[model samples]
Target chain A: MSDVLAIAEHRRGELRDVSLEMVTAGRDLADQTGGDLHLAVISGDVDDYATQVNREGVDAIHTVEYGEEFNHDVYTQAIEQLYADLDPQYLLAPNSVNGMDYAPAVAEGLSLPLVTDAVDLEEDGGLTVTREQYGGKVETTIDVEEDHAAVTIRPAEWAQAEGDGDADIEAFDADIDESEIQSTVTGFEEVAGGDVDISEADFLISIGRGIDEEENITLIEALVEATDATLSSSRPIVDNGWLPANRQVGQSGKVVTPDVYIAIGISGAVQHVAGMKGADTIVAINTDPNAPIWDLADYGIEDDLFEVVPALIEEFGGDVPDV
Target chain B: MKILVTVKEVAEVEDEFEISGGDIAEQYLEYDLNEWDDYAVEEAVQISEAEDDVEVVTATIGPERAEETIRMALAKGADRAVRVWDDDIESAGKLDVETKAELLAGVVEEEDPDLVLTGVQAGDESNGATGVTLAEKIGFEWAAVVNQLDLDIEGGVANVHRELEGGVEELTEVESPAVLTIQSGINEPRYASLRGIRQAQSKPLDVKSLDDVGLSADDLESSLAQTDMYEPESEGDATVWSGDAEETAGQLAEFLRDKGVVEG
Candidate 1:
C-alpha cells in the first residue's frame, strides 16, 4: 500500500471547502493505490484544524504550524519538508490561489509531474485524472506516468465529504525558517460578497460574449432571479466590462460544476467551455445554432436570445418558485 | 526598469492539431510563437521603447529552432535574447509546466528583472500555470490576467489592474520583482521588421542547459501526474433551425429543452 498527502487550504483560520474536496480526491486516489490517506493541514496553530479534519478514511493527519497564517514561502518550505520526511505516492492539493503558489514550487523542487486544474478522479491500479482544456471545450484524461505525482484538483469540481467521524490526529513538525519563506503575504483582503465560492455552486447561469449588449443582462438576471440561480459569465463578457472577473467561467476564468448550467447567447468557445462543461446538465440559448456550445449542451436553442430569454423570464418568473 | 519577456514557439491556434494515439502530433503543423507569449513580447518592447532605463530581453526554452521565437521577439524589440537549449527536453511534453517554469525562474533569478512579463496563458497546452508557479518558486508576487501595470521600481511597488468578471480591480501596491500574466487585449503584439529580424541574429543569444543551471536531469522530469494528452472529441454537426430572429428564437428554445440545457 502507498500513501497520499491531502493539503488543507484555509484563509484566516476558516477552512475553504476546496480543502475538503482535496481530501475527497485524496481518499479516491488512496483507494486506488491501496494506500493510507493522510491529510496535511499546514497552518500555524493547526491543532484545532487537525482534529477537525481527522476523518475515518484519513489514516493520519500532519499538522505543521509556523506563522499565524499562510505565507507562500513558509507553506512551500513546509510542504517541501513534509514530502521529504513522509513520502507519498501522490500529493493532492486544492486548486486555489494558495495551491497555485506552492503546488508548482513543490513539483519544481521535487522534479515531479505537476498537473493543475484537475476536475475528476478515477481510481484504477493507478489514478486517471480528467481535466478540461482549451476552456472546457475538450476533456483530457491524465494518467500519472511516474510513480509519484502532484495534482491540484480544481476547487468546486469534486464533491465535499460531509460526515461525523473522528480519526487519529498527528501533529507533525517541519523545521522551517521565517527567512526561508521568501514571499510575504502583506494582507488578506477578502472579496466582499465574494465569499460564495462558485466551484461549490450546484446551480449556475453563465453568460457569454454572445449576450452582447449589457441591457439584456437584466432579462437574463430576471431568468436567474426566477430560478434563484447565481449569475456568471465568460471572459469576453467580463472583458467588455459587462461582468466581474470573479463571475467569469471558462479558461482563464473560474471552473464551475453546477447541477444546472444555463448558457445564454454563448457560442461555447473552447476556452469558455472548459470552465463549466462539468455541470450535470447544461442548457444553451443562443441565436447561432452552430455555436460550439451546443456541442456538449444537452439542450440548445437557436434564436435571438433577446426574445427567447425574455420569454423564459416571463414564463419562469411567475410559475417558478424561488429556489 | 528592464523587462524580461519569456516566449515559446508553439503550434498556431488556428491550425488543426492532430491528436493521434492520445498524444499531440507535433509534425506537419505550422509552428509560430505562442499567441500569448507574443503579446508578452509586444508589451515589453512597447514599454521599453517608450520608457527610459527599460531594456527588454527575449528569453525562451527549446532547441535551435526556438531561436525563431526569440528572433521574433527581437524583431518586436527585445534588446537581447537567451535560449535555454536542450532540444531533448522540449520534444517531450514530458517536461512538466513547472519544470519549464523553473527554467524561467532560473533566468529571472539571474537577471533579477524589475518586472517579469509573460502571457496570462499560452495557446497550445495553455496550462497557463507557469507565471504564478514560477513567481512562487522565485519568491515574487504574481498577478494573472493583468490588464494594466503602472510601476515605480525604486519605490519597489507596482499598481496593477486585474480584470475580473464585469469589473476591474485597481491594486495599488504589489512589490517589485513581481510577475504579471498579461491578457491578450491588454496590448497589441507587434510584427517584427526585416531590419530588426536581421539584427536579432547578430545580437547576443546565450544557450543554457539543465546542467548549466545546476539542476539534475531528474529536476527536468516530473514526479506529479502525467497527462495522457488527447484532443477533445469533435462536437457533432449542429442542428440548425433557421428563420427570422423571432421564429429562430422559438425553435431555439424548443431545441434547448430537448437538449436539457434549459427548463422544458
Candidate 2:
C-alpha cells in the first residue's frame, strides 16, 4: 500500500480549518489506497498545530518547527526532504492562498504531476480528480498518469475531520537552506475597514459585474436608500473601484451572514459564495438563468437587473436615480 | 529593469451552451485576454511606466489566434511580445502544470527578464500553479496571489501583499529575479486608446516555434489527461419569480418583507 502524506496549514497563531479538512481528504485517499495517512505541520507553533491536527484517521504527525511564519522556501525544502524520507504515493495540501504559494513549487521540486483546486477525488486502481474550470461553469475529471502525484484541495469542499485520535507526534528536522529562503513574511494587515462593516448588516443589497459601469451604481444606491439596507457588492465591483473595499463580500473580503442578502447580477463565484452562503435568506437577480448564484438562492429572478433594480426601488418606495 | 508577463487568451462560454467532444462547443466559446492576466499586464505596464528605461515584454504560449490578445497587452503599454506555438502545442491537449512550466521556462530562459509576472491562474483551466512551477523550473523566487507590489530596484527586493482569505493580506518581501503571479483588482486596467491601438499594430509581435524557444516535441508531454467534462447538475431549488421585471421585483420585495427584512 502506498502511503499518503498531507500538509497542515496555519496562519498567525491559529491552525486554519482547512488543515482539518485536508486530513479528511487525505484519509479518504489513504483508505482507498489502503495506506497510512501522515500529516506535516510546518512553521508557526508547530507542536500545537501538530497536536491540534492529530485527529481521527491520521496515523502520524510530523512537525517541522522552523520560523514563526510561513516562508515558502523553508516549506518547499522541508516538504521535499519529507517526501524523500517517506516516499508517499500521494501528497495533499490545501488550495488556500498560502497553499498556492508553495504547493506548486513543492510539486515541481518533487518532479510530480500537480492537480489543484480539487473538489472531489477518487481512487480506483488510478487517481481521478474532479475540478471546476471556466470560473466554476463546468466540472472536469483529470487522470493522474504517474504512480505518485501532488494535489491541492479546495477549502470547504471536504468536511473537516473530527474526534481526537492517538497518532504518533514527532518533530522532523528539515534542512533549511539559507540561500533558498529568499522571501520573508513581514507581517499581516486587515485592509477591509471603513465606515461600514458589511458583516454586521441585517439587510444587504449586493451588486456584481452585471452593474456594467461605475455611473450605474447610483440606481442600486437609490434602492439601498429606499430599503434602508447596507450596500455591498461582489469582488468585481470593488476591484473596479465602483464600491469601497469595505463593502466587498467574498473570501478575501467579508464573511457576511445577513438576514437577507439580495445579490444583483452576481454569478456567485465560489469565492463570493463562500462568504455569504450562511445568510438566513438569499435572493438573486440576473438575466443569465445559468448563473451559479441561483444554486444557493432561495428566490431568483431571471431578468435584466437594470429594469428589475429600478422596479425593486419603486416597490420599496424609493426613487430611482437616472444615470 | 525588464519585466516578462505571461498572457493567455481564455475561452469564455456563452450563457446557454452545449458540450461536444468532452469540451465546450467552439462556436459557443468567445476568446479574450484572461481576466487575471489583464491585471498582470496592467501591473507590468504600470511598473514600466513608473521606472526609467524599464521594458515590459509579454510572452504567450498559444497559436496565432492569441496574437489578438497579445496585441491588447502591447496596446495597453507592453513594448513587445513573443508567442511560442507550433503543431505540437496545438495537439498537446490540456497541458498540465509541469508541461506549461517547461514551455514558459523556455521563454524565460531566452528573454531572461529580471522579473516575471503571470495571472494567478488561467480562467479556462484555473490550475493556478503555472507561475510557481515555472519559478521552480527556472530557479527564480516567486510570490503568488500578489495584490500589491512595491519594487525596490536598488535593494533587489519586491515588497508585496498576498491576499489571503477572510480579508487578510500578508505583507512579504521577495528577493528580486522573482516571478509574481498577479491577482485581479490589484490595479485598475486602462482601456487601449485609439492612438495606443494604432501603435500596437506596428509593435513587434515575434512568433516562434517550440524549437525556436529551445524546446522539443517530447517536452510537450503532460502527466495528466482529461477523461470527462460536463455541466454539473444544478442542485438549486430556487423559486424562480415569473412575469416581467416589475412583477418579479414585486414578488422579491414581498418575500423580503415576509422574511421581516424590509418594511412597507
Candidate 3:
C-alpha cells in the first residue's frame, strides 16, 4: 500500500498548530489513496509532541530524537533516511520557515516532485494541488505526475485534525553524519524588547502605508487607546521604522488569530491576508472602495482615515485628539 | 567575489483574466520584474558595491522579452545577465519546479559564483521551490526567507537572521557558497535612474539555449501539468457603509456594539 508520511514540527518544546493541520491533510490524502497515515517527529524529546499529536487517523507515529531545537543538517539527514525506509508515496510538511528550509533539500535529494504553499489538494485520477497567484487574484491547478511527491501545506488552510488516537510510537534511527553539517544555529533573538506582542492581542487595530506619514500613526494609537485594542501595523509601517518589527502582521511577520482585527488604511495584500485571515471578525477601513481588503472583511468602511478616525473616537465616546 | 541572482518576468494583470485556449490571455497582460527578486537584486548590488572585485550577475529563463527584466537588473547595478531558453523547452510545454531548478542549476554551473541569491517565491506560480531545489542540485548550504543577511567575505560564512512564524527570528551561520532566498522588506529597492537605464542597453546580456547548457528535450521534461486556471471564489459579502464620516462612524459603532465587539 502507498503510505503517507507527515513531518511534525515543534518549537520551544511545544507542538506547533501546523503539526496537527498537516496530520489532517495527510489523513485525507491517505484516505483517498487507500493507504495508512504515519507521522514522523524529528525532535530531541519526541514523546511530548508525539503524545500531543497522536490523533485519530494516524496509523503510526515515528520518533527520531535528534536535538532540542531545529537544525537544518539534522532534519535533512533524518528525513532523507526516514523517507527511504518508510517508502511513503506522499510526504507532507508544514510550509513554515522550518519546513521550507529542509523540505526543498529533501525533495531535491530524493528527486521527488514538490509543490509548496498548496491551498487546496485533491486526488482525481492524479494528485491535483491548487495555489494562489498575483496576490490571490488567480488560482492555478498543478497535477503531479510522479507517484511519490512531497507537499508543503500552508497553515490554517486545512482544519486542524481532531479526536484521540492510540497509534503506536516507534523509535527511528536516522544515523545522521555530523561531519556533513556545515551550519550551526548560533541562537534565537527577539526582534524587539519590551514591544507589544500583537499575535497574542485579542483586538488589533493595524495601520498600513495609507497612514501617510509617521505622525499619522498617532491617530491609530488614539483609536487603540479608545477601544482597548492593541496597536499593530502592516509591513510598511514596520519597514519604515514607525513601528517595531514585532508589531507587524503578515506572512513575513506575525500570524495573528485575534478575535477582532480592525485593518485601517491597509490594502489587503495576499502576504498580509495569510497572517490575519484566521481572525474571528475583521473590519476594514480604507479610502478605496475596490481595495482587496474588503473582500475578506466582515465590515467595510470606504472613507478617508482622517475623517473616519475622529468620528470613530467620538462615536466610541473618547475625546478626539487634534491632528 | 561573485554573486548570482535570478529574476523572473511575471504578468501584472489587475483586471480579471480570461483563459484563452487553456492559458491566460496575453493581450491584457503587462510584464514586470518579480517584486521579490527586485529586493534580491538590490541586496546583491549593495554587497557588490561594499566590497572590492565583486561582480553581480543575473540569470532568467523565459521568452526573448525577458531580456527587459534582465536589463532592469543591470540597470540596478548587475554586472551582466544571462538568459536560458530553447525551442525544445518551449515545445515540451509547461516547466515544473524541478525542470526550472535543473535549468537554473545549469546556469549556476556555468557561472560558478561565490554565492547565489533568488527571490523567496515568484508571483505567478508562487511555488517557492526553485532556489532550494537549485541549492540541492548544486550542493550548496541554504537559508530561505532571509530578512537580514550579513556576509563575512573573509571568513567565508554568512550570518543570516531568518523570519519565522509567530514573529520569531532565528540567527544562523551558513558557510560560503550558499544559496539565499531573499524575502521582501529586507531592504527598499532602488529605482533605476535615467542614466542607469540608458547604460543598461549596452551592458552584456548573454543568451544561451538548452543545448548550450548540455540539456535536451528529455532533460527539460516536466512532471507536473496544469489542469486549469481560474479565479478564486470570493468569500465574505462585505456590507459597505456609505455616508458622511460622522454618520458612518456612528453606524459602525452601533454595528460593532450590536455584535458585542465594543462595550456599549
Candidate 4:
C-alpha cells in the first residue's frame, strides 16, 4: 500500500535521460509516502538499462526482457502484470513520446485514475498533480481521489538521479500473449537530414506562427542573410511547409545550443523552449508583451517583427526584401 | 469502408486573461478547432478523397458551441458528424482519461468503423491519452504520434511513421480497425471554401445523448478533480527595451554587436 513503481523508458538500445529523471520523481514520492521505490525496465538490453538506472534511493529493480524497441502492446502487458504483482500505491512513467503510447493503455486496462505530463506531484493527505494547460499560460492542480493511481511525469522537469545504489535486481517473467500483439515495428528512419544541422549553429534566427503568411517568411530570410546567422523556426513553420523539418527546433525537432538565439515572432511554448534554452543570449521580438518567450529572453522588444526586422537588416548592411 | 475522425473545439486563451473558479474566464477564451485535430480531419478527408466507396465521419464529445467547429470540419470535407453530449457530460468537469475513453468507446461500438483517426492531443487540456485509451477500451490496435500513414485497405494494414524524439521516426505496421492519433504536418489542411461552407450547412449533423451511445450517467463519473487553477508566476528576467521599432532595433543591433553575434 505504501510503495511506488516507476517504469523506465529506453529507445534504440540506449537508455533515455528521462529514465533517471523519473527515478528522482519516484524517489521523492516514495519518501513522502514512506514507501520503497521500485523500478521496472522492460525490453531491449534490460539488464544493462536496469543497472544504469539503479540510482540511489531505489529499493529494487525489476527487469522484464522483451523486444528490441518499444511496442505499446508489450509495455501494456508487462506493466499490467507487474502492477498486479506489486500493488503499489502509485505508478510513475515518463511522459515521453513512447510513454504517451503505452501509459494510457496501461491505466485504462487497470481501471486506475491516470494523469499525464505532470510537472509536479505531491502527497499531503491525497495525491495532487500539477500540470500546465492552455499551452503553458496557466497551471492547474488535479486531485486524484483514489488509493492507487498512475501518473506520467513530463520529461526534463525533474533533475536526473545521481550516484549508485545497492538494490536487488530480479527478472520478472512477463506473460506476453503473441495472439494479442496487433502491431509490428518494421524499421526505423532518421529524418530532417539535409544541408545544415541547426544544432551546430552559433546564432539562430527562429521564427514561429506569428510570421502569419508564407510569403512573409522571406523577410526573416533576409535577416538570416544580413546577420550571417542560421535560420530555424518553431513547429508551425515546418508544419506549414514553409521550412523543412531539419530547420525546426523543438522537442520533436532538434535541440540547439547556440551562442545567441533571436526568437522573432515566436511565443515560447514549453515544447519550443526545450530545444533552444541553452543559448548564451536570448532575444525575443514579439508584438504581444505577454508572450512566454519573454520569460526566457535576456533582451525583449515588445514590437512587431515587420517593423523591427527591416530596420535590423538595414543596420547590418543587408538587403531588405520588399514583401 | 468508414473512417471516424475525432475532433474537439478547444479554447485558446487571450494574451491577457483572467482565471476564475479553477477555469479561465469565459470572456477571455476563444474557441476554435484544435490545431492537432485539424490535421487529423485533413488526413481523413484526404484518404476519403483518394479511395472509392469510403465514408468519413467525425465524432465529438462537446457541447452545442462545438458544432460550429464540427461544421468547419464538414466544410473541409467530413461526410457527416456525430456529437455526443448531455446534462451528465456537461457537468462532468475536467474529464480523466478513463472517463473520456468510456464515453468514446460507446461511439466506437456504434460506428464500428474500419479506421479511427484522432489528434495527438487537444490544445486545451493536452491529455494526449484519450485516443489510445479509447482504443484499449474498445479492443482495437492503435499507434500514437503518427506523422505519416499509408493505409492499405486490401491488405488490411496501415504502415505508419510514429514521430519519436530527436528527429527520429519509428515505422510500424498496424492492423486495420485501428485507432491512429494523428500528429501535425502530415498533410496541408485545406481551407474551407465558400462553396464548401454553403454545402456544410445542409450536411447531416447528428446529435446524441449518452443513452444513444449505450452509456449512462454513471459512466461520466471521474476520480480526478481540478482543485485549483491560476497563472503561473512569471520568471521573466528580461531587460525589455521600451521604445518604438527603430530605437528598439538599434538597441538590439548594438547588443548583437557587443556579443559578437554580428560584426559592427
Task: List, residue by residue over A203-277, the lDDT tens digit for candidate 1.
Answer: 787887766677767767777776567888876676666765578787556778887787877878755766887
Instruction: Specify the highest-DockQ model's number.
Output: 2
Over the stretch A108-159, how does candidate 3's per-residue lDDT look in tens digits?
8888889888888897567898877666666788899978889998887888
- Residue-level lDDT tens digits of model 4 in A124-230: 76899999999988899999998889999998899999999888999999999988899999999999899999999999999999999999999999999989999
**lDDT to native, each model:** 0.70, 0.92, 0.86, 0.92
Q: Which residue ranges in model 4 land beyond 4 Å of their true spot?
A: none
**CA RMSD per model (angstroms):** 7.2, 1.0, 3.2, 1.0
Off by over 4 Å in 3: A192-203, A209-230, A240-242, A255-260, A265-271, A277-280, A286-292, A302-323, B15-17, B243-250, B253-264
Looking at chain B only, the TM-scores across the models are 0.82, 0.98, 0.92, 0.98
DockQ of 4: 0.87
Worst 10 residues of 1 chain B by lDDT: B163-172
lDDT of 1: 0.70
Per-model TM-score on C-alpha atoms:
0.71, 0.99, 0.90, 0.99
| Residues B108-221 of candidate 1: C-alpha lDDT, one tens digit per residue | 877878788888766656676788778767867666666666776677776666643313233435677788877765665667888988888788888987666556666666
Q: Lowest summed-lDDT stretch of 10 residues in model 2 chain B?
A: B92-101
Shift in Å, residue A105, candidate 1: 0.9
Worst 10 residues of 2 chain A by lDDT: A173-182
Better of 3 and 4 by lDDT: 4
Candidate 3, residue B7: CA error in Å? 1.2
